[model samples]
Target: MVNGPAGRPARSLTQTLPDGVRRTTLPSGLRVITEAIPTTRSAALGVWVGIGSRDEAPAMSGASHFLEHLLFKGTHKRTALQISAEIEAVGGETNAFTTKEYTCYYARVLDSDLPLAVDVLVDAVADSILDPADVETERGVILEEIAMHEDEPGDEVHDVFAEAIYGNHPLGRLISGTPESVTPMTRTQINNFYRKRYKAPEIVIAAAGNLDHATVVRLVRKALAGTPLDTGAAGPAQPRAGDKRVRVQKPHTVVLHRDTEQAHIVLGGVGLSRYDDRRFALGVLNNILGGGMSSRLFQEIREKRGLAYSVYSYAAQYADSGLFGVYAGCAPGKAGEVLDLIRQELERVASSGITAEELVRGKGMVKGSYVLGLEDTGSRMSRLAKSELLHGHLMSVDELLGRVDAVTIADVEKVAGDLLAHRHSLAVVGPFDEGAFPPG
Candidate 1:
């Protein structure tokens, strides 16, 4: 286990952001970040394109995601099977994903295979074959994937919440486009879309774990050498947020449809975006509210009142928008009461300022988590790339910890008050009644 600042071992495989991670950018617009650690024998490599669902236009809602799938089907020198076999043969794992604001392809491999990993990833993105047959099969696979997401209630409601919060913006759309759009996407459309977005200079390559920085950069540059120059054009911006309330009515009230003998519910509201200066304070409020077992939501709702088995609150920070959320699973009959309890806690926390003890705990948790992230190379690379994309610079560990530490009780109270105000939005799944939820 990797040790944190307080000397306790961390549980997450991707914890700890390394100070050794060096960052640089190529003239072609590719950001290069590297971390070298002696504790682990493996390394993680990734290329993060600063574009995602939000960047696509109405005519190409799922093109970014479709391109991600096509990249893995095959490249100029390797078949899809060959790419998979090569990575697995080296005891490495490779995959890619598309998010609202970014798309990334990554590999975690033995240190010796770092060069080979770089080659595979660079080729996959820069020189994909996008085979016609594979494209057809992937369309079917992605549609099924979309269906799978709908089948999971907890997952579906947040998508619903996103729709409610962001309205008709591209941000509200699913990362994977609809069955209708993806199924009918043609090869020419894919190629044209790829040329316009995928080759942007805003792409970033990041790596963490044991490796040589110069060697890794060299490998990346060499693999992608012959690729055409990036056009240097930024993608379109995401839509802004507004006061919008939308209720999606699917069949089945008290959708206690699942027989797990319990109901899952998620409550969320417009939180704070990445560039929002109050984000650090909101993070503190989240910690005190439901970020951990000792948090107020867990203590009062579960440990003290025995309302449910699990409870937590968190904030998802995006480039232009963010979400403050609370999630819990309770006995079917107690679901409505649990919602009341959560609101009550929100009101109480907002009106009555946090205690000194709570402040300490929240700060400690946030700082501790930040310190622990420096241990893995992949995390280091991800942090650099994400910070660059989201904040436009690399934030040192000390700087982040300072921000978390600087949060005051008043800061926490103010954010809680702002978040819990009537401007909030929510989504629920389970044996729930819409009447029971707090209205915006």
Candidate 2:
């Protein structure tokens, strides 16, 4: 039997590992996790900054995402072109992204070039030259990106559905700010925002690959030393609205009319929060539904009937709350029938529990996938840091596998029932009749 977190006789995973993989913390509050795979000579390193759209204030909305792009433009020591050239010279890949709850910059390189990766990322964050000229250019680039999303019917619909689910909360806001918001953001505003939020020494730096723990510490320390600590803003709480049961129908037959071969249909509801205890059961339940082609949704909607090309159910787990959804693209004429099939599967999961074989397969698949995620250094580092940020501690791989295995058929039925009890807000982007979606 495994001991719990509070147990006196604690298990140590570090002691059993090879000498290179180590976990350490600095006095400045940065958590450094490194894993050295001797057989392989490549490494993946990532610095996860625990701030995203959810952290943005109304005035500084989309600042996190904007900062993500601006950081790559130039730094104190390296020009934008030089930064790209240097990484490419080492056969390394570098990129950054902003999500609802966090922003990250990462690179993958040969083990010998780990120091270069660390230096580039640290410099990008610290000496982020949010040049007024580059800021203006990037603003245009961001606006074009925003326009592209606006023009895309399927993407617009999902954004609408998210707004309906979260209402006026930050969760409802688009990660890419509106054209008006993105346009007026000045270089000063961008720099001030970065200085206040991201110029912190408290962020996490994790590397996975063939590397030394002490070496990683030295590189990170030297990279971040003497940087002003960020006394970050007390970001406002993202509102968690209760279950919503409503439907909004567009006046026109097809919204954002596009000339496409197939129609895009999105159906979903308010899902569980990251803190919810039933998250594991809910995840298993989703996996059994449309996570894999062998699942019920695929068999019923695609394989058997041949109604749609793709059908899947997913849950977007967030800090405060999440959304559970299913999406598919079907023949323009078969949208209604496809909806019925999806509803039937949802109702069946809620009413009649999955078979024993199905339960076993679902649990086994979840367990296998969990283990596979640790094979890559970047994946392991992300899993460790994200779990800590969201769950307040690290949960071992065995613990996660056990949780996935512990979900019973009854638990699946309960989660299904809870989700299906509410009417879903529908978002359809296609060429169809006005009465395509009835009121929920």
Candidate 3:
């Protein structure tokens, strides 16, 4: 598949990292990454495409998610049921999901069934038919899915908050576009998106669990030999680029009045990008602030005052922007007190920073979760793919733990002052009017 000068064998272009993980690029611009976990009997494989909602035009908002469904509907050589049956017959599973930055169709099977896994997953991604009748059938299913999501006030308010924060940017829209946008989306538009974005240059096949890198490569090469997917000359796509700044006019409030018992609130402001070095410090700050039961928010709001049962904070990082938010569930009448305490705690941290004891606790919690989570082959596969997709390099476990260890108390203070010192916005879902909101 190499595209060098005529008549010579094309040497592989690859980089093998620590932990025996390997990243290889085919001549056709397809990238493949794999990890061999000797103790595991099963293998997990994913075909990741680099197009998601952020890549869509305004009119094409939900196309990436829609294509996720269509790929499983059928392919040129296999019916939809047959496609799934093959995997299930081997005691395997197949599923897919779409996110803001990418889409993945993945499978888990016995290591002996890897060739079948590669063949089926590649066929689904590279050879789907996108039948007209199947498109129409899936339209109703997706509409009902939207209706299902909207019915849950807690779930829907996050989208409302995103719209409030991001305004008209594609990042502001729901992953499942509005009923209007998706209802009338046609097959021709979907086919065009698939043909254009689902190319070898933007695809990665990642595998973990018991496996061989050379054999996996050989299987993938034989799988697409004569197809239109055979690329003449191209390289992998560059990471998505856009600096759509969050344009909030001071602090704001977006309240959806659903007749619910507890107010679901998300409060805070813009924070770090995925590439920022300070993210390690930010993680520590999030932990001390509201990441666990022993965290400040959980201890103060839920345990001491009994104001809420679920109270926490989180950070969401993207290619060029991110969001940091604190979430709590409480009664409508107590919303004011909750917001005031939140503000007071943030002011305290912004002014004096967290104590040294808190830093050690935060580091311990982060390390525990990090190490335990990576014990799964699926988790390893995802990490390997995402590192290659976003950063174009792999960070070892030792390196990750070291980064967390390096976060100092002063680092926390400076980051707290920089991110949490500003006037922040609020989003609420409950039976409350604008007049009921707490002071900003």
Candidate 4:
């Protein structure tokens, strides 16, 4: 048996994978997973590291995002301009983003250019210079980004809602971080955080489209040679455990006063974790409640009453905790009415549940979105990486659809009752005082 995290037993490196997909774990503990799609002439490759904003301490809040920018600035092998110019010369694209749980640097190019993409991305991620000058420049850019984010009330309300739910928890903090955190964070702090946290065992390399899995693995191995990721033997890190519960603050109303044209509001509460079996049921409920224009919220708030231009329900799941929220952007005068209607509908669904027709329609929406999203190489590559990095196993597309199809009306009702039972926290961003919204 291979050594896992903390000396626990881990899966063998040569386990069987689904059709068109393959996985290999290197002696250095880096994982390479791939999907071969012969019909397309393009390929998408992603280097996914299992570290993000949530992994940071308060002093190092934006370090993950800052490191993302610095990685692209320059590596020992290539300058920043050469990095972009090389990819663009072949009509390809490369970019990276950091989320709450992980950071991904990806490139999409013709299948013939896969080698170039692999070399560039791996070199950048595994051997960045992290120059002090580049760090200072990125610091200014990140501060401006934080300011620009505050200007968008539609977006800011979601952050407010998260803050209301999680309070001072890491999940509630901004991914870009605040001006205070970004300005004071020194290069040494960030570099130390990067070297300490970005472990080979905690990384996954995924590629898809018109390629052979063996060839992709070979390319990645060659690219990683002599890099920081090339190290002693170890098994891949295990996925984050789900048993540890996240501590949350009590529900309350939080209003950010901004003189905006539309009032942005979110009403929500605690939700199911990603590992929960009832998540399938929650997915169905979300689609029915606000998945599309045909959803209950859209039909009631926008089409029927003309109360809001946008209204939707969303669910976000993490390893141990999650959030369920309903967002509506409406005129300031109509905010109260819109919020009451949302509460009424939620209560109605909770008490009575949805009908048979709604259940079928919800299931169809979930299945169609999942399948259609995989039509491109990027999504497929992302699926491979996320399954390995986040879930620790890749469920076949058919298996996922089957799981959704098995959800019955009873399952939906049970989840709805459980999720909606708690008092919802409110977050409002508009021209309003702190007490404009009542306490939950």
Give the number of the best model, judged by TM-score: 4
lDDT of each: 0.75, 0.74, 0.86, 0.92
Q: CA lDDT of 319 in candidate 2?
A: 59
Clashing pairs in 2: none
Judging by lDDT against the true structure, name the best candidate: 4
Query: Per-residue CA lDDT of candidate 4, range 99-166, in tens?
Result: 98999999999999999999999999999889999999999998888889999999999999999999
TM-score computed on alpha carbons, candidate 3: 0.96
Q: Looking at model 4, which ten-residue stretch has the lowest summed lDDT?
A: 7-16
Candidate 4 is scored at a TM of 0.97
lDDT of each residue in 1-440, candidate 1, tens digit only: 22245544332122233465665555455656777776789998888887788878777779899999888998779999998999999889999889988899999999988999998888888888788899898888888889998778767766766666666678678888888778778988988878777763557788888888778777877887776533232332222332343332221212324444566766666777777789888877788899889999999899998989888997877766677778888887887788778878887887887998998999898888877876676676677777756565567788888888889988888887787755345566655555545452
| Superposed model 4: Cα runs more than 4 Å off | 1-15
Could you tell me the TM-score of candidate 1?
Answer: 0.86
Which one wins by lDDT: 3 or 4? Answer: 4
Q: What is the TM-score of each candidate against the true structure?
A: 0.86, 0.87, 0.96, 0.97
Quality of model 4 by C-alpha lDDT:
0.92
lDDT, model 3: 0.86
Q: Per-residue lDDT of 27-116 in model 2, one digit per residue for the tens? A: 444557676677778888888777788678777778888999988999877899988889999999999888888888888999999999
Clash pairs for candidate 4:
none
lDDT of 3 by residue, 1-440 (tens): 34577765455577789778987888778888999998999999999988889889888889999999999999887889989999999999999999889999999999999899999888888889999999999998888989998778777877777776777787788888878789889999999999988888888899999999988988888877765576556777766664655454356888888899888888887878888899999999999999999999999999999999888998988887778888888988898889888888888899878998999999998999899999988889999888888777789999999999999999999999999987788888999887677547
Model 1 accuracy (lDDT, Cα): 0.75
